[model samples]
Target: MDERIRHLGFGHPWLRGGPGAGDGGETSRLPWLSSLLLAVLVLVGTGFAAEGQPDREPLDVFARLLLLAGPALLLLRYRRPVVCVLGVALSVLVYLGAGYPYGPVLITVAVAVFAAIVSGHRRAAWWAIGLLWAGHLLVVHLLYRHLPPSGDAAASWWPEVGVAAWVAAVLVGSELVGMRRERWAHDRRERAAAETRRADEERLRIARELHDVLAHSLSVIHVQAGVGLALLDSDPEQARTALTTVKAASKEALGEVRQVLDTLRTSGAAPRAPAPGLDRLPELAEQAAGAGLAVELAYDGERVPLAPGADLAAFRIVQEALTNVVRHSGSRTARVRVGYGTDRLTLRIDDTGPATGDEAGGSGNGLAGMRERAAALGGAIEAGPRPDGGFRVRASLPLTPKETP
Candidate 1:
């Protein structure tokens, strides 16, 4: 099979307002043109031969041999797009040697330029368009003296010049249209990739939410169960009380788990209690007190209205901070402060204890969860040792979405 046959195109099918991606059907025009040009060559050669004109008139047998190669060159117009433009233009030069009319051959050159830009090199395509028509003008002005000039004043042959000018203009205009189509294709791909990334990130956020719900509840239950098992021998009554606390905590954990999983795993709407806000700080303090941590709750400023998202985010930030204090900070007493203002809400959890060892290594996902919650609120958090003793975690969140109406 010939390699040139593979690249022949039937022009663009989406010339009208059609889908850009289309199955390009055969146009049925190529064979017709090939036959017409062939008939022109045979009839003209026979008539002139009957008139006894020189068989080697201007383009002699040698030049006709190259002209014989022109149709084979036409098959190459779409293949080596840039190279074929020069080939057709060179064929035009060879045709000029035969005194053949140059009008019809210019279209093949235009098609070559159009093919180049559509193949994705805009600059090369543009240059090909210019140089192709320029070849026509150079041939007319320098080589073919038989053609008429422009009004006896202009050096350019106005007939051939007009034909070449339109060829260049149409090639360039077609390429501009092709560029817009290519850019649209590029933008569509980028948008699809962005949407996929957003979906993946959303799935990850839900995963983090599930982890937070399960880990906090399970950690509390694990501590209570261990205490109950330790007291099973001597303090059987206390052991029973610990088992009751574990059972209640486990039931509450199940409810929290259901709410979270329902929001994620199904289309059912989440519960509306507006989530936990700054108003629930005392309740959290009381729960910490039950767990044998000395909790001191404090507040400052007015009860400013908060965006529900900000409110819930603030509450979770403080909850995770305090949970870390219980598990890692080894602090006897923890102080939690909630300050509400017109513009923003600030939360701080400071724990005071004997500073012994640092919390590091294999601790997995405790402190990182606090930072993640804080970031989700469009806020900032810091956890590190304070000056005197113990550790502190502070997070600040805005009352409303800043970039929203």
Candidate 2:
């Protein structure tokens, strides 16, 4: 029921205000006021027309007032369109049967029909029109058979023709108005739904970005902090170096986090720094070594440039793979191999075996995050214990040719 009122442009503003409500509320009221004014004008015109025709008898004051009442009642069209239309139809019948001047009394019927259709009461509107037309035919038949005729009966049909045309015009106009209102409402709903979907997607993207950034950086910081504490008594100098690495890692993490926050604060209006890509793999290997892992990087085939999405995914996958190696693998050595091909880029990170301690149970989002990134770019990832007795992560990212400037 509420939706119907909204589509008809008559919903209460304070109860359900939103875009277009002001205009819609005003528009919905126009039909009611116009119907009332039209009815009043028709009542006044009937008096004038009756006075001008000396052959016609003036209607009693009570009958004229009743004719006026029909249109005034149209003020309730918005609240109860079907009832108002039916009431107006009955009043018009009474006025005609009482031999009142048939001036603009028909205008009241037309307005009632229009109100019913505009208010989304099509069946009621049609029924009211049918009743009016049948009554009109009956009145014409009575006039032709009982009244003394001065001219041909064919000429008397003109009034009925005019009334039929007026009713048809009202029906078409009301239907057009209703259709336009429905279309506008549909468009507004679609735009709102689209905006909601965009917001959801953006939130997911930001979540993935924060998860990847914090997880990798925090893992490195955790390992270096452990090293610093373990060597504090045995090798004071090495302990200081470990502490220094921790400070540097923390600073870098802070800077990256600030960048992300700035982007969010500005609503992405500010330009961002270049994203990390495959070129940063060597630097990543160095950082892993500083965290106590023995790291080696190798490449096979000719290196080719990759699109921005594929490049970022490849970099993140490798970063996550190496972080896992440093934290979970017990062995000291790990190998990273990049195999470039004509259609795709392949990355492999393998560690010797499982490590001791609680590192394995650390936040388990790393592998899942890597897989999400790879799948987002139409790539694939595989990570598990290798048959050679160590953990391995392999990712394949398909390449797209760079667009020419």
lDDT of 2 by residue, 106-139 (tens): 7777776676676566766777777777876775
| Number of clashing pairs per prediction, in order | 0, 2
Instruction: State in Å the error of residue 382, model 2.
Output: 3.8
Q: Write the per-residue lDDT of candidate 1 for residues 284-375, one digit (tens) a residue.
A: 67555545567788888877667766776676666666666656656768998888777777888898866536542224665676677667
Clashing pairs in 2: 330-354, 330-355
Model 2 has how many clashing residue pairs?
A: 2
Q: Candidate 2: how large is its RMSD? A: 6.1
After TM-score superposition, what is the CA distance of residue 301 in candidate 2 from its true location, in Å?
A: 3.2
Each model's Cα RMSD? 8.6, 6.1
lDDT of 1: 0.60
lDDT of 2: 0.74
